[model samples]
Target: MKTILTAATLIATLAVSGAAVAQDFVQSGTTPTLPQREGQAIYNAVCSGCHMADGRGAEGAGAYPPLANSDFVESPDAVIAWVLNGYRAMPPLGSIMDDEQVAEVVNYVRHNLGNSYEGSSTAADVQAMRE
Candidate 1:
């Protein structure tokens, strides 16, 4: 009887532990990292003015490209170049922001925008493209 009781207790403990592990995995699903958080904040401060808070630019005005659902942002190279050199209407901000800041902003737009791309951009990535 004692052996049976011990086995039952062990099984219960294993089941509880398994449940805890499963819960942890569920909570961690595809959440952004630290840099991505910073990137979001920076986007709110600087980029939001022209791009708008939701990344949707002025539609008819054609003042800025609508970044929210833009396919161009999916390409890391295109994003980097656009930020560095600026497009026709947008002035170049590459000179104003540091490499790290640029990366953070790019990452912010890519991840937080309506059409989000799943990847992180680093300062090194931007610097390499600059050269």
Candidate 2:
């Protein structure tokens, strides 16, 4: 119990102290000044950390996998599955986000990221995909 509390306290301290450093690493995305759509905003906030702002994922310990013109994303349901249930190193974001937000981000990736898929997924679709 004491060890758990200590670990939690240490984590909180590091998070507070590293907040500035974390911001420095994550502020590379396209920051929209106009009235931005929900999808774009969510990508800039969440997926951009791993998938990147350009959707061209970076190489490191097991590449983040680029979303731009990806054959993987061509199958739209795969995107939903990965985001909701996690498909390897990618964390599950379904719990953190509502259905509408998931739909927005998934649609954003499909339409943008060098993709031209003439389709969209609704919140109902995302809701159904949730684990």
Candidate 3:
């Protein structure tokens, strides 16, 4: 009985902590901002929540499509637009991130996360998409 109680307490504690971490991603009344400016940093801080740290994605409350070896990520424009405009269950994060940050994340997701796409996206490209 004591062991069961301890397990229940651990579960409850983990649930609360997880919810708190998830809240960091929510916009709330104002737009939430991420301090990381680099591509890999931004992806780890923001995208990794749903996409997972390994970029394998997750499925629980919702379905988060994987970024690994994905054809969808080949188009930098599409990823940039999706990040800015949001897609389906994904929230639009343009308000929180600058153009450079967006480009960095695009490049990071494209080149890393089990992807080996060539070329890079410039901040100017991200700015153009914003317009």
Candidate 4:
């Protein structure tokens, strides 16, 4: 019973901390409205830590590849696969995010962050890639 209670307490604490971080993210307006721009939300929350707000990656312990004007970011299908399986350095986001979330973030990165690609990826596309 004591162990169960402790586990519950830990879960609740994690929930509250996660909420706090989300609240802070909302207040910052770095990600914007999730309903409207889930991609930006994921990017700001997950990618911005290493990729930077502008998507210009840096070299520290490992190379954080630049997304700005990077031809490597062209294909949405390829991008989805990379996010799900990870290429190198970047950990696979599929473990943490759903297909829709992956699509949104991929779309966000494609069009924004100094990119001008005329293509976009839908949630359906991400779902297909996941399968």
Q: TM-score: which candidate is best?
A: 3
- Model 1: what TM-score? 0.65
Q: Which stretches of candidate 2 lie over 4 Å from their true place?
A: 1-37
List of clashing residue pairs for candidate 4? none
lDDT of 3 at 18: 59
User: Model 3 misses residue 66 by how many Å?
Assistant: 0.3
Instruction: Give per-residue CA lDDT, model 4, range 4-99, as digits (tens).
Output: 887788677557645644653543344333433488878877776567668897554467888878888998888899889988777877866667
lDDT, model 3: 0.84
TM-score for model 4?
Answer: 0.70
Candidate 2 per-residue lDDT, tens place, 1-131, comes to 99888778867754663463355334324532212248888787677766777899865435788998888888678888887888888888776667777888889999998997878988899877763
lDDT of 1 by residue, 14-125 (tens): 4764464444323223433312236766676556656766888753234667899888699877888888898787776676566787898888788877777888889999
lDDT for each candidate structure:
0.70, 0.74, 0.84, 0.75
| Candidate order, lDDT descending | 3, 4, 2, 1
The alpha-carbon deviation from the true structure for residue 18 of candidate 4, after best TM-score superposition, in angstroms, is 15
TM-scores for the candidates: 0.65, 0.70, 0.78, 0.70
Ranking according to TM-score, highest score first? 3, 4, 2, 1
Better of 2 and 4 by lDDT: 4
